[model samples]
Target: MVSKKQRLASVDALRGFDMFWIIGGEALFLPLFALTGWSVFHFGHGQMQHTQWHGFSFYDLIFPLFIFLSGVTLGLANKSLRGLPVSDRAPVYRKAVKRLFLLILLGVVYNHGWGSGIPADLGEVRYASVLARIGFAWFFAAMIVWHCTLRTQSVIAVTILLGYWLLQTLFGNLTPEGSVNAWVDQHVLPGITYQNRAYDPEGVLSTIPAIANALGGVFAGRWLAHHSGDHKAILKGLFMAATVSLLAGFLWHWVYPVNKELWTSSFVLITCGCCLLLLGIFYLVVDVWHWKRFTYIFSVIGCNAILVYLGTSLVNWQYSSKSLFGGIAAALPQQAAGTFLIACGVILLQWLVLRFLYKRGIFISP
Candidate 1:
């Protein structure tokens, strides 16, 4: 079995890899797209950026995947919790709750401020978001793990997903266009509508499926903890995930539309499938094949993911780069240079923070 410390490296590496995209994936790619003169028509739409009403995208996968990984990490961290006395478990549970609240609070601060030119409006700021969803999911998933056996938790997860599908289809009101999207948004959340009277990425109804995403990770984590050394177990997980994803995508497409914004059942399954596939690859390559050095770079960012995420949110590292690289961007005619410079600057700033945290042994966790 892998030691807890060794498992931490894998989890951190995965977390860092996921956040790298969240922080600047689009910015990094936009410059390339500009240089290629690709039609902005397809790229400009929020669907390309975020999902429309009910669809999937590369962007939509990031947040949920992170949450899923969080569940896996929590399982790995708390594997020994089962052996501990009730007195010992209480403190751990309290700490987990505290961390969840702290993550939600930080997410609010990030959404509201970060010193961007955009005016700070707490009232208008979105109360619910990707981070908030993750926090809630993590808290709930942890509670399930703490209280129930792995078998029972798995049953509960499946029940929630099925129940949510039924509720949305039968109970939800239809929109003017005869869509359940708006109806669920309005009625499910009640007074807490979307931030701009538009849509809520972390809406009430969508959270049901989101919980499944986290629980999927919990299942994976429990499996990992118990069968870390069994090569066949990893293969079994990968195969099972792929099968579930395909079936869910095919079946749910008939009704829910596989929308990432809605986080429909199909979307959750597909994304979780992708996540499982990726995790399997990492496990095979790093753990089984023993690819150590290359994984370190991604692992470093993973180790201090929360710090870099919050720091990037709060501080405009672009300003610091503008002092040096911004002038260089000015020399170029098109916006490409400016975009590239900003992207590079953000990457460097993130790396620097990660490096500093690594040196100081400071890691922020939720």
Candidate 2:
């Protein structure tokens, strides 16, 4: 049997792969559209960009995928803590709280906290952030997992989805200013919202539905834990659940509409389904089949995801990349070629930084 203390390679690789897109991996392929003018590259480029309002895109999947994976880690962590005394769990809870607030604080920093010196006014800060959403969803989902049985957790997940849909129907429309989420953010959130708009994608009300994504990951993690030794069982269970989730999501989209901005019920269902599907494939190839070599880069990045995520904001990686590789890009025959080369250089530099941390066992997580 696989030891609970041991990490799942597939999880790390999948996380790094997801983070890849966030850290400009999309640019590597995006420039292809301009260079070759191929329909295929155009389609790939389209997939990299988020849907404007009320649709799904591959880019939309990235945020929830990370949150879902965070839930999976929480589940596995809970499993490891199962046999411990109640008193021993205190530090675990404390650490969870610390991680939650830390991520939230860091999210603030990512939103330009102190970037232009201190904000002259309290309202200058944008408190809603991607990392903050992850922290909130993971924290609430962890609380549910700590208290509830699987069946109860399942019920709660349903309640959250349905309840959010019902509330949206009653109080919110799809518009930026009219969204119930916008109202919530304006009234409750202390500082500025995203782009100083009425609605923040990671705002107060929208976060309620995001918890379902984390819970879905918890369910996946539990399934993996239950069938740790049975590879076939794991694949079958994951695929079956994913199929059901996808069907449900599509069906609900007729009414609620799948949207990443509001993070509607349908959006949560669809993204969670895709996440499960991706996790299943990653597990099959990376873990079940033991294909470990190619995944090393992803594993390194995943090990220190938060670091690179924040690094992109705090550090001038693009400047550094251009400083080192600008001449190389300039020497390329075409502007598109130069753009692609610079993108590659950016990723290479980020990977080297991650590799350095990975080799020295310097992983930093929330």
Candidate of highest TM-score = 2
Least accurate stretch of 10 residues (summed lDDT) in model 2? 114-123
* Cα deviation of 344, candidate 2, in Å: 0.2
Per-residue CA lDDT of model 2 for 217-320, tens digit only, reads: 99998888778879999999999999999999999999889999999999999999999999999999899888878578789888898997998888887898
- Candidate with the greatest lDDT versus the true structure: 2
Write the residue-wise lDDT of candidate 1 on 1-366 in tens digits: 235463744555677778777566557666767777666633743333776556667777778888889788767754446667889888878887888788878777767532333665344455566677888888888778777787888799889877876766775532323446556665555334454454466776677778888888877776777776887886687668767876777677777667776676777788888788777777776677776874776777887777777776788777877776887788888787677877788787778768778878887676
Error of 2 at 124 (Å): 1.5
Off by over 4 Å in 2: 1-6, 80-86, 114-116
For each candidate, give its TM-score against the true structure: 0.84, 0.95
Give candidate 1's whole-model lDDT: 0.71
**In angstroms, how far off is 342's CA in candidate 1?**
2.9
